[model samples]
Target: MGFHTFDIDRADALEDESRYRHLSAEELLAVLRPHPEMTVADLGSGTGFYTDDVAPHVGHLYAVDVQEAMHDIYREKGFPETVETVVADVASLPFDDGALDAAFSTMTYHEFAGEASLAELSRVLRPGGRFVVVDWTATGAGTAGPPTDERYSVGEAASALENAGFSVDRAESRTETFLCVASV
Candidate 1:
């Protein structure tokens, strides 16, 4: 099976499981404190994990996801009124240029519908706005987390963002994750 279909089963299972959900949200906040008041868009906000935690810190949060089922959870969980849940694809988000102060995706970039996702991410931020990407490392035995063919290391993701018109500020490996902070 192709990469797109490779994790369909796991993604479906994730919709009902909250195991990694809270931990991911906490990890996101750890890196985003400096820009706490900035408007943020939690792209591919599966289960509103980061959405709910981030809403309290950011000026506003656009909790966007392509899945209605996920959005329904956001609503049911009674996320702060500050969150605006929108149903949309990550690669083709329906946001406007310079409209966001920052954007974040946790363990979601590998699932990009295609290259258009990177372009869309670069297009929506203001010139100096930050883009924080937190995803599983694409190497080491922990590579077991994502399909080998579809993952990217921090270096690879940094290069892709640079190609998409971002000025990479940081690209480094964490204990078990890869992270990058870039400016559009």
Candidate 2:
């Protein structure tokens, strides 16, 4: 339902640029369709890595992470003025109903992937708002990212979203990761 490993010790690994090979910022922005006036949230935002990549495009961006220590590292690195850190779980976001214009999680989905979390996402995102997920897929060979068993396939992600009351727009797989986009 929520992330169990709130380890800040691996914070530096989150900053690795090589991760873009799995999901690039350009691809994320394209799928997210972010607007200048949009209020977005980076779900499971670790050290503001991908959050920083998205900040300049959005009017307001919430870096939501379960770990405050990760937010501390994000603050120390100095994020954009538009980026605000919110320490919270994916299953229990602090925002009101229909509060987010869009939300996304970068490599952190498996940690909080479940019906409750998906339902919470569906509850917070406004009608027609986008919710994109880019994470390691279970079908991939055991290489980088989390173990294959812990990951969700694109189909699983799409099915979970559909069950949670969101309409899945696109669900595709890469060599090691999957991209699933859903709309509220």
Candidate 3:
């Protein structure tokens, strides 16, 4: 099971630009390689931080979050024309089968990592669709993000994706985080 959901009061902290130090928008875009015609989702898109960065690059961007308040915060900031807020859980998405060309999550893998969520993601993405995940690793120093005990190592995450029938093409464990790119 995943850890607790983020405190809504701390939603403001999610807008901090310094968070790029953990997972840069450039790195995420490179991993996704999104095209202007590709449909994508920003899973757990709180405050639409990285979602905004990816919206203009994709045909449609779904800012999915379990918390409607997070979407409310995003609305206050403004949404891209192509971006739509979806109040849903990763384990039970509202999208149809093979509806997405790609999906990515920034520092949110731990909060929604599980078999049900992975299967839902696999169900929504078409064949050869990409799924990029960047999150604080279990092996990290615990100087930032969640507690180390609540996180997953890159190997563990890779195994989870593999079990979900995803072909992991790229996986890297950085100083404090892990980046895993998989395709259905």
Best candidate, lDDT-wise?
3
**Candidate lDDT values, in order:** 0.72, 0.89, 0.94
**Mind sharing the TM-score for model 3?**
0.98
Better of 2 and 3 by lDDT: 3
- Using lDDT as the measure, what is the rank order of every candidate, best first? 3, 2, 1
Q: Which pairs, if any, clash in model 1? A: 91-117
Residue 179 lDDT in model 3?
91
lDDT of 1 by residue, 1-184 (tens): 1334223334444444363542465666776653556878987786676677788887789988777777775577678877888887767777887888888877777767246777888788877888888776667456345665667788888888888888998888765568888888
Q: Mark the regions of model 3 whose C-alpha exceeds 4 Å error after superposition.
A: none
Instruction: Supply every candidate's count of residue pairs whose N, Cα or C atoms clash at under 3 angstroms.
Output: 1, 0, 0
TM-score of each: 0.81, 0.96, 0.98
lDDT of 1: 0.72
lDDT of 2 by residue, 71-106 (tens): 989989999999999988889999999999999999
Off by over 4 Å in 1: 1-27, 34-37, 142-144
**Model 2 regions lying over 4 Å from their true place:** 1-3
For model 1 the TM-score comes to 0.81
